[model samples]
Target: MKTRIVRVLVTDDHPIVLDGVTLALQNTPWLQVAGYARSGREAITAVERLKPDVVLLDLRLPDMLGPEVVQALRAQDSAVKIILFTAYPDHAALDAALAAGAHGAVVKDTERDDLVDAIRRVMAGERVLCINAAGSSGAALSRKLREHGLTRREYDILRRVAMGETNPEIAVALGLTRNTVKTYLQRTLEKLGARNRVEALSRASQLGIL
Candidate 1:
């Protein structure tokens, strides 16, 4: 008997990641790339129109978070299984994705064979969590970030900084003094193991702070 081809819709804000995954799945015998999308809205539209059997989604999207997208897809009452495919992996993110109705979780670096296995498992009504996630802390900056004891306001400032805001601009926007903004940014960097704004933002984004 011929094996069934599992139709999949892949979503990611980064075009390169989306194309890479789609191409990887193209040769899988039991899987078919139903379609691919670049953002949360496009992913939703594709799901509505194509109704693929499974959806591979990115956690941090331009318009919506991965959990938000998962919830939205579930709200549509579609039986299409969702797998959170992200570059950053941790226990917290995976838990959130699962809570939002994702059937599995995989990172960007997942081996093609492992990715194929994840999709196959999800199609068979199993919840799949990639190997990397098993030992990951899942929280932003891993738990050590929290150990530094940064405040929520500090994280907020760092998030804005990640979006490319300057100290003066952040101060103006947050109604704080320039000194205060500078102080917060420095503290955030120190706590997150960053030497500068770029490194801070990169590390924080990896930990899902952004």
Candidate 2:
């Protein structure tokens, strides 16, 4: 019998990381490194162009957040599974990643064997949520979000605002009125102790809120 080969695209900005990961995957007979990307935009483009079966994506990209990438890819209606490979290892970030439709996650320092296992597990039609040893759980992320007093609507507004969408544009995109977006954004800012949109996004990322 022959082993099934998994087509994988690995994305990371660091050359060393890319090289290391490529080397690691070379040891796995069933995994093929189809392509590589160095930025969020490149990764998105590669996904479309290369059409890999799975993506091992770094959570912190030079051009966009990992969850944002997940959301963007899904919005394009592609069914390719994505696994976040991040060093940040924040529980809240993982929660947001999972929420955005990521198929799995693994910390940057994950052992070669473990990462291979995670990829196989995800390909086998299971959700993988392997966190770093020091990472928090989904429950902790929910608690923090609740403690910050942000409603789901407010979170949505903040994400649009973070992407530099105007009130009218956000309204149109979210199917809400401009006033509603403005209201939710204001409340989101207040809840996050931010005085402006940029600060709100910065604080939200720091808190792993988005």
TM-score of each: 0.67, 0.79
Candidate 1, superposed: residue stretches over 4 Å from native: 138-210
lDDT of 2: 0.81
Clashes (backbone N, CA, C under 3 Å), per candidate, total 3, 0
After superposing candidate 2 on the true structure, give the runs of residues whose Cα lies further than 4 Å from its correct spot. 133-135, 139-153, 160-178, 190-199
**Per-residue lDDT over 174-203 for candidate 2, one digit per residue giving the tens place of the 0 to 100 score:** 899888888888888888888988789888
Candidate 1, residue 142: how far the Cα is off, in Å: 7.4
* CA lDDT scores, all candidates in order: 0.76, 0.81
Model 1 vs. true fold: TM: 0.67
